[model samples]
Target: MDKFTTLTAVAAPLPMINVDTDMIIPKQFLKTVERTGLAKGLFFELRETPDGKPVPDFFMNQPQYKGAQILVAGDNFGCGSSREHAPWALLDYGIRCVISTSYADIFYNNCFQNGILPITLPKAEVDKLMDAAKRGHNARISVDLEKQEVTGPDGGVIKFEIDAHKKHCLLNGLDNIGLTLEKKSKIDSFESKQHGTQPWLYAQAGR
Candidate 1:
């Protein structure tokens, strides 16, 4: 995981509601656990035809939206079965932040775990950003995690709320493993004490 303090980049507009995890990376691409190559499958169905031809009209396929790091999406984004790969694919594709009116609970948490910021704003505010996103690379959306604010291209600022603990974890680049490591000394001490008290627990297998 990477620290997410602030980000300013072109935002790709995805105005469709009810975007599920399958639509994001597709089932065919979920076999592997590696996150790097999943970008090729991000929105695979939307970006390519059944015959494997590119969909030139899709926002992601358009030249202006290439390398977009922010996504302004419609309501109920990432709705469907819980899949950690959804956020992995988005992060692999360079999407550091996602702004939507609503999101599925599992996907929202997955974003934070994967170092992606999933923002939930009112419909009016999201709509405003969506309009700005239509301006292509010219309109850059800025997200400041510390301030919990998102500034649109028109200089409009919208404030959002997030859990304080999650904010701290993201700011410090602490995933579950990283968090556990923070208490290494305590864990080591506890193990040493336990070993002294419960010698049989550490006895050799043959014994």
Candidate 2:
């Protein structure tokens, strides 16, 4: 996972509500456990036609949003079954953050775990940003994690709240494994003591 201290990038507007996990990466793309290569499958159905042709109508398919790293979407974003792959796909596609009026609980939690900031703001503020996103490459907005503030291209600012623990983890680029590694010395000491007390087990294995 990467540290998310601050980000300023183009935000793609996805004004559709109830954008589910299936619509994100599709069920067929869930076969692989690897996180890489899933970006191509992100918004698979929306970006492609029934015959596998590019739709050219989806927000992501537009030239202006080609390299967008942030998404401003409508309410009920990321709804449906819990699928971690959806976040993986988004992250792989370079989306480090998503802003919406509302999000599914599971998806919201999943975003934090994957280092993707899913912000839930009031409808009015989201609509403001969504409007700014319509400006194409000029949709640059700065998200400062330390300040818990989002700054638009025009210098407008909005504040958001984050869980203390999750905020700490994201700031330090600490995932579950990274967090456990923080106690490596203590774990190593405990293992050393166990080896000393259970010398027979070690000797048997070594023999």
Candidate 3:
């Protein structure tokens, strides 16, 4: 996972509510575990037509938002199945942050794990960001995790609250495995002590 300290980039406005995992990457694109190729499948149905042509009206399909690094979305974003692929797709598509009025619990948690910042702000604040996003590439948004603040195009700032532990992990680029690795020396010492205390246990495992 990458460190998410601060990000300043174009934000794509996705005003639709109740966006689920299937709508994000679709079931057809779920077979592959690799994250890189999933960007093409992000919002696959909304981005493509029946013939697989890009939809001109879709926010992400539009030229201005094609490289958006942040998303200002409606309420209940990332609802439905608890698929880790959803965040993977979003991250792979260059969305470092998602600002919404609300988000599903599992998806919100998944975002933090995947180095994506899922921000929950009041409706009024989100609406402001959405409006800013509508201005296209000119309206770049700034997300500063250390300060827990999001600054919109017009220089208005919105403060958000986040779990301290999750904040710490993201700042240091520490996932679950990375967190465990932080105690490598301790773990190695404990294993050495256990090996000496229970030589029979190690011998039994050798069989």
Using TM-score as the measure, the top candidate is: 3
Give model 3's TM-score versus the native structure: 0.96
Worst 10 residues of 1 by lDDT: 198-207
TM-score between candidate 2 and the true structure = 0.93
lDDT of each: 0.92, 0.92, 0.92
Using lDDT as the yardstick, the better of models 1 and 2 is: 1
Clashing pairs in 1: none
What does candidate 3's lDDT look like per residue over 1-207, in tens digits? 899999999999998999999899799988987878898889999989999898888897789887899999999999999999999999999999999999999999999989999999999999988988999988799999999999989998899999999999999999899999999999999888989997787896882
69-150 per-residue lDDT for model 1 (tens digits): 9999999999998989999999999999999999999999999899999999999999999989989988799999999999
For model 2, where is the 10-residue window of minimal lDDT? Answer: 198-207
lDDT of 3: 0.92
Flag clash pairs in model 2: none
lDDT for model 1 = 0.92
Number of backbone-clashing residue pairs for each candidate, in the order shown: 0, 0, 0
Cα displacement (angstroms), candidate 2, residue 54, comes to 2.3
At residue 198, give the lDDT of candidate 2: 82
Q: Is candidate 1 or candidate 3 better by TM-score?
A: 3
Q: Model 1: number of clashes?
A: 0
Q: Which portions of model 3 miss their true places by more than 4 Å?
A: none
Error of 2 at 57 (Å): 2.7
